[model samples]
Target: MTSTAKTPLPPAACATALDPTAEPFYLQVLQALDAAGVPYVVGGAFALAGLTGVERPTKDLDLFVRRADFDRLDAVLGDAGLRSELTFPHWLGKVYKGAFFIDFIFASANGLNPVDDGWFERAGRATILGHPVRTMSAEDMLWSKAFIMERERYDGADVAHVLRGCGAALDWHHLMDRAGPHWRVLLSHLVLFGYVYPDERDRIPAWVMHELLRKLHDEMLAPPPASGRIQGTLLSREQYLADLRHGAGDARLKPAGTMSAEEIAAWTAAIGEPHEK
Candidate 1:
């Protein structure tokens, strides 16, 4: 098998933080999707929090769907008056609606998209803005984050936060097995993020994270070949750091806009209850 070299983290990742408005938008999207009965699981940064417990606000909503349901998704969003900008069948697999964008991902871009199998099986339920929804399992979120680390795209903090939040709850064996050949890269990311301090490295349980790192170091010295085309959206370490610095105080970080009295009254007459207040 051809092995791919990992790219070093870019400087911009620490510079461009996600807009603080992303959280409310996320809630809005979830409500809209749930109301429409569209099956989706939150992924990417927002989903990462469910796994790692890192609480940085995300810039966009990342939702994954079965390939068979793509057309249905298109129809649903179209009816909602949301426009889509398709970016796949080329490099980046993405779909955008106004200020919101969702990355269309298959399970394995190189082989088969194994996204649907057991997707809900690995999800846990949570309430967002009084709406009930299912999210990715903490372990699965870690697996997804670990895979991203292999590509050398984002900061170790993302992974660090995951480790801190769900380390005790993670299934080390399952995580190792799912990480496949890219285990060491993930471990190095954890170390870089200060999640695994040098002095405390030995103390990390001999379970999944530690063993996976050790095995990858001893066995897979040659890395996997980069599969998907590298998207420019990948953030560098510097950008990630910068974002962390400024993201906390972003002005857009506030409660979502409440509907005006007229709008609320119209919605109450139309939907029979107050949807937004």
Candidate 2:
């Protein structure tokens, strides 16, 4: 039950939730990107609210771009009187105007799914702050959020809302392929989706459940691999620190994963201590 229909944009009233002073900067950033012809899709709270009709206040905006566009954005933002930094070399960068900023994401923190051409191919047309723009596809948004299971921030609920909201409109096949070698993570989220929305269980295609279950069965029967890979780290770097210290390889590290050792150390160091703002 996949679809190509564009999601309705969240109401302009939602913009009122942002800091009043920052609103102008937000609009300027959008206008700057359009003027510069830098292709990007609106994501983060904007996409979540668009797909699920659930609005939440957010200080930061998210724009998904290809890796190369991020490099170009460095100059684009600067020329527009804005500044930005590559917050995480592997996945994210932030554009700043005073204390308010927008995130330009090119990949996931775990280094699994990087933004690529396929993302734009599936993106939907939308308008925000009086500027025409693309919206992150439901499938791509779900793929990114599925891996965000940090102790401070778990997105399983967000994943379930997307499933409930998109229903048959979701491109299940594309999502499955996007999951690739990490299909189990997708399967687990699907299981939880059903648990969260009992009456809407049938929203998921029967064949998907059947296929994933069959794969799970095969996985269960297979012999454990000789290598000790702790996939929990892929879900949350901080939560799995104990495992790494106790002698287990992180699935997010090189030779076994997509990220580098230096990148992992830097990411771990950036984790802020849990506290009230």
Q: Name the regions of candidate 1 deviating beyond 4 angstroms.
A: 1-32, 50-53, 89-97, 102-114, 147-153, 190-203, 209-277
The true-versus-predicted C-alpha distance at residue 181 of model 2, in Å, is 1.5
Error of 2 at 70 (Å): 1.9
lDDT of 2 by residue, 1-277 (tens): 6524344333333232466778789889888888888888888887777777777887777899888898788898898888899888888888887778888888988888989888889887776666677888889888899999987889999888888778678888888787787999999999998788776777788889999999999989999886888899999989989989999888998878889999999888888943111
Count of residue pairs whose backbone atoms collide, per candidate:
18, 0
Instruction: Find the 10 residues in a row with the least total lDDT in model 1.
Output: 7-16
Cα lDDT of all candidates, in order? 0.49, 0.82
- Per-residue error for 111 in candidate 1, Å, reads 7.8
Off by over 4 Å in 2: 1-16, 273-277
